[model samples]
Target: MYSPRFIHCLVSITASIVAGTFLQSTTINSEGSFTNARQSQAQKVQVLSVEFPQQQVPIVRFPRDVYPEIKFSEITQPQIQVQANKHLTIITIPTSLLFECGKHHIAEKAEKALNQVSQAINNRYSGSWLQILGHTDSKGSSKDNLQLSEQRAVAVQQWLSKQHHLNVSMVTTQGYGETQPIVSNTRFDCFERAIARQKNRRIEIVIQKLDHQV
Candidate 1:
């Protein structure tokens, strides 16, 4: 018994009401989600801001007297016999220092003296040269005495070269057996001539061609 126009009008009104209700509900839900998200971000920021104090490090100190120490071994000096002149210095090694009874080998006790002599020669006469002369007594045969004297001189030269590290070219050696005796040969009843001749047996070290400017 209802009319067609009225039925259509009622259906249109019902659809409008349902659409408005759905739109309102969607808007409320979106607003609530946005508010909840903003609150959670604010709480996270507060938790990151905590009260923490800075701790200072202490400075360490050392003793004022502390210093680097240096240590060295003590070096004992050798005894030096220096005879310096206006031109040159003559370093003499006694026969007893270089040899025994008619012997040619150098004594171990004389090493210090030889080293001292070599050092003196090296330091004092840098421009000069050394001459080593060997002397002997007249008791033995001329040939044998001459050979012995030569051997003695060579022994001295070897010591200088080996122990003192001296240049062989800077030194020259010669032997004058009984021929260049310092004391004259005399026959006396008191053995004075023998004693004097014994003194003649020796080695003479002479520095020559010195640089006078030194």
Candidate 2:
């Protein structure tokens, strides 16, 4: 039989060991929970706080000095010819740049340029009316030239209206064959005349600002 003092001492020692073990377990669990919470918070920050680059969402504009904006699209001699007026911006796209000689079909390379134009229109000129004008030189017969010019204008209009899903009603087209000659196709030499004809064959994209903003 154990003495009373000895039994009391054993009870105290057992109680103390149990208390220490419980305390140590509680501390370990608390530390683990804190670490897990920190990891979860960091993961949430990484997932939700994603930042996009400038190129992904860049701002595009049609800058006007209160004038019409005419942007030239070319690869080799790329240029922007902006005439700042209150009413119209005439963007002159050379036929030579858009098509092969004597053909109205827009070339594969011209698609990229047209896409850029479409994107710009979507960004800034959603409310404005766009008039595309096709012109030709005096090299062909008047009837043939008229048909060709109209076809070219219609092609561009189709791409803008259908391919880009732009406002078709806001877009219009007209063809002037050898009637409005900014440069004469009448040259004494055949080579000079060809060059003049190339110049005369051009498409003008006119951006018209309406009196009331839509």
Candidate 3:
């Protein structure tokens, strides 16, 4: 026996309480979903970071004229040849100019040529890679020739670093012996063979252009 107005009041109160409870539950669920989405995005970013790492140093080549300080005419000589391209600048010196027969010591006649080479490296080719490749004629045994060639290359490298105060780390030496010859070492004609042998015995100075400049 509740009055009509009282019953109506109770129903309205219950409805309001139910509506408030439902709204609060909806709000908590929405917050949880938003948090989950943010965590998922962060996890994705972490995965991407682990997938790709930093890179190493890159090797780069340059066109000729990159270092215009090296003069081709001044470095070139009667027995020495200078060749340049995008990859390397090769300076070929006859073995007779740098060394005596069966010896690795730098001769007195080689001072002028060596001075020019040192100047070029100091002037424009600083911090660049240098390779001194030694070659010989086909007169000695393969093992002996190889050792001699390596010795010659090392001698030149030492002279450059010691005399000119060039960076030693930037220089490397290798010996090809008689394996790479510019002319044929023939035995048929004595005079022709001697000429060919002279051409074959040489040292090649290779300078490579680098991306990193000091």
Candidate 4:
């Protein structure tokens, strides 16, 4: 038969072994959880770092050229075309609207459109350089067309100076006779040819900034 004291001691030893095993298991699990938490924190930091970059991109811009403004509403002429760019502004008027056929004189009926042009120059672009370019269609001999174009340009310059009292020194004139046609004049139909020729006959007022010498 076993002694009571020996059995009590054996029971105490078994209890101690079980308690040791449970403590060891708890310690290992706690360490694993702490490691996992640290790993998750590192992953969050990495994701944030990727989403926001450290360096920033730079923006670039070009400088605008100084130029004068033209009010389009002030020009009531339907046939006039006003075009502007970074460096120059061009006002194109059909010669047929300004003068009679084969004539270099400005018609009295065309005073309204000319008045608007003069007003624009006097208002905003008086200090700018003005170039009056005259063009003719393929109607007459090249020599005659060239002379007519020059005369027309000169007449416009004179009218602007004498009538409007603008500075004549700022204005210059040129003629391109049947050479710089805006449309093709080789159409087989007479009406189409006439239309093309009419479109080709025009006077262009080119306005440039003071920095550019005409």
The true-structure Cα RMSD of candidate 2 reads 32.2
Q: For model 4, which pairs clash?
A: none
Residues 1-214 of candidate 4 have per-residue lDDT tens digits of 2234423432332122211111111112222344576754443221212232343212111112322334476687788877664556678889988899999999997799899888877766767767788889988798999899999999899999998997778878878777777788776499888899988899988666434423
Q: Rate the local accuracy (lDDT) of all candidates.
A: 0.58, 0.62, 0.69, 0.70
- The candidate 3 region of ten consecutive residues with least summed lDDT is 18-27
Off by over 4 Å in 1: 1-85, 212-214
Error of 2 at 115 (Å): 1.6
- Candidate 1 per-residue C-alpha lDDT over 1-214 given as tens digits, one digit per residue, 9 for 90 to 100: 2234323332332112211111211112222334676754444222323334443222111111221121111112322233443443445456776677888999787776676667666665664566677778788797888788888988998898898677778778877677665566666554888777766687766555344523
lDDT of 3 at 214: 24
**List of clashing residue pairs for candidate 3:** none
Off by over 4 Å in 3: 1-71, 211-214
- Pitting candidate 1 against candidate 2, the one with the higher lDDT is 2
lDDT of 3: 0.69
TM-score for each of the candidates: 0.56, 0.59, 0.63, 0.64
Q: In model 4, which runs have C-alpha deviations exceeding 4 angstroms?
A: 1-71, 210-214
Candidate RMSDs in Å, in order, are 47.7, 32.2, 28.7, 34.3
Best by the lDDT measure:
4
